[model samples]
Every structure is written in C-alpha cells, then in structure tokens.
Target: MTIDIRPDDLTSPEMAELIAVHAQTMLASSPPESCHFLPIDGLRQPSVSVWSMWEDGALIGCGALKELGNGGGEIKSMHTRAHLRGRGLGRLMLDHILSVAKARGYTDLWLETGSMDAFIPARRLYESYGFSYSGPFGEYAEDPNSVFMHLHF
Candidate 1:
C-alpha cells in the first residue's frame, strides 16, 4: 500500500471519524480518568501538529506532535484504523513524528500511553525507536494506569 502521511486539518469530516474512533478506543482500553486522547478540537491548537495517513484516498491512520517548548515535544492522538493494525502503519507514523520533531529542533520527545496489556506493542515500538520509561513530564501527574516514555536527541 502506498500510504501518504501529510499535515491535516482536524476539521475534516474524515478526521472527525478518525478522532472519534481513537477516543472510543482509548476509553475502552482505560478508565476515563486515565484516558489522555485529545479531542479533535484540542488537536487543532496552535502548539499541536496533526497528520493523517491516506491510501487510495481513504483515511487509514493519524498522529500528532505537540510542541512543549524548551526544545521538548509530546506525541499525542496516534491511532491506526482498527482494520489496519499490525501493518507497520503505526511505525511509519511514529517515524514521521520523530522526523518532524527533530527537524523542529526538539531536544526531547515524550509520550504517555496506557499501562495495560493492550498498549504493550506501542511501548515496544517506542522502545525500538529509542524511547525509554520516564516519569510524568509537563502537566502530567503520576497515574497508575499511565506509562510515560521519552527520548532525547
């Protein structure tokens, strides 16, 4: 599949569906208090850069990078359509996010994900890309259901 990942506006109808699915998945995987998936409107904030992957003109996945200032960034809203999982699309999206963070001069990249079994693959993927376990950073607070990871360039 020729997947095209590009910056996208969160207001698109396709994006709405993607974000809704992402939100639903997060909620299903974690408690409401532990879910950090940002809503579509939040992803449109000036500090967040959103990207969507498309193949044959159909949206297949999406991810975002949030500028944290002081040369830091946070990965947010990363999700692949349920049918498209295990196809290396998540890795491709992550690689794109890391490249953009580097090009933007971020010295560190951080992310928060669920600590449940469902998130093991994601944690492994981040580890393969050099992200290591870390304490909560930025505005995040300690949460048993959350796992934090970071990579420094």
Candidate 2:
C-alpha cells in the first residue's frame, strides 16, 4: 500500500472525530472499567505530538508521541482502523513512531498498554520493535491490567 504518515494537529476535526470513535471502540471492547483509551484533548498538551496515517486518501491509523522531558518519550494512542488491519500497516506505524521519537533526541521510549487477551498482539508488536517490559512510568501505578514497556534508543 502507498501510505503517507505525517504529524497532525490533535484538534483537527477529522482526527478528533476519528480519535473519539477509536476510543469508544476500545473502551467498549475492553473489560468492565478499563481506562485504556487516552483522550484526544489530553494528548494535545504541549509536550505531545500526534500523527495520522493515510493510505491512498483513506485513513489507515494514528499514533502519538509525548516528550516526557529529559530526552524521554512515550507512545500514546496507536491505532489502525478496523477495516485496514494486518497488511503491515502496524509495522509502518511503529517504524514512523520510533523514528519520530529518535528525531526528537529521546533517549528512551516507553508505553503503557492493557494486559489483556485483546492486547496480546500489541505486546508482541512492541517486543518485535525491541521494547522490553519495564515498571510503570509517568502517572501510572502498577496494575494487573497494565503492561509497561520501554526501549533505550
């Protein structure tokens, strides 16, 4: 697929709606009270950067990077539209996210993902990208449902 990945304003109408839909879907499919979906407005804070992926004019996926200061970064809200799952779109997204993290002089990249059967694939993907299991970072406290992973770039 001819995909184009670029940074986008989190407040863009299209992206805002897309993120809402993605968050709703994620929460709906999640357990009783999982807080897995990061809110769009929250991600629009000055320290964060968001990106949307497009393939031949169709939306493919979106991901965000947050500068955690001290040259550390975090990955937030990585999602591929349901219709376009598989076909290497995820690899593309990860590659782009990682490259962006590196360009910002981030020495470490970390992420928090749910630890559920639905998250197995995501865990696998992060491992494939060399992200290893680590203790929670940022505001997260250890939870049986949360898996923290990080990479030292």
Query: CA lDDT of each candidate?
Result: 0.94, 0.84
Candidate 1 worst ten-residue window by lDDT: 9-18
- Cα lDDT tens digits, model 2, 58-153, are 777898888888889989888888777777778888999888888878899999888878878889999998999999898888888788999998
Give the 10-residue window scoring lowest on summed lDDT in candidate 2.
28-37
Candidate 2's error at 130, in angstroms? 0.9
Q: lDDT score, residue 66, model 2?
A: 83
RMSD of each: 0.7, 1.6
Per-model TM-score on C-alpha atoms: 0.98, 0.92
lDDT of 1 by residue, 1-153 (tens): 689999998878999999999999999999999998889889989999999999999999999999999999999998999888999999999999999998999999999999999999899999999899999999899999999999999
Error of 2 at 80 (Å): 0.2
lDDT of 2 at 130: 90
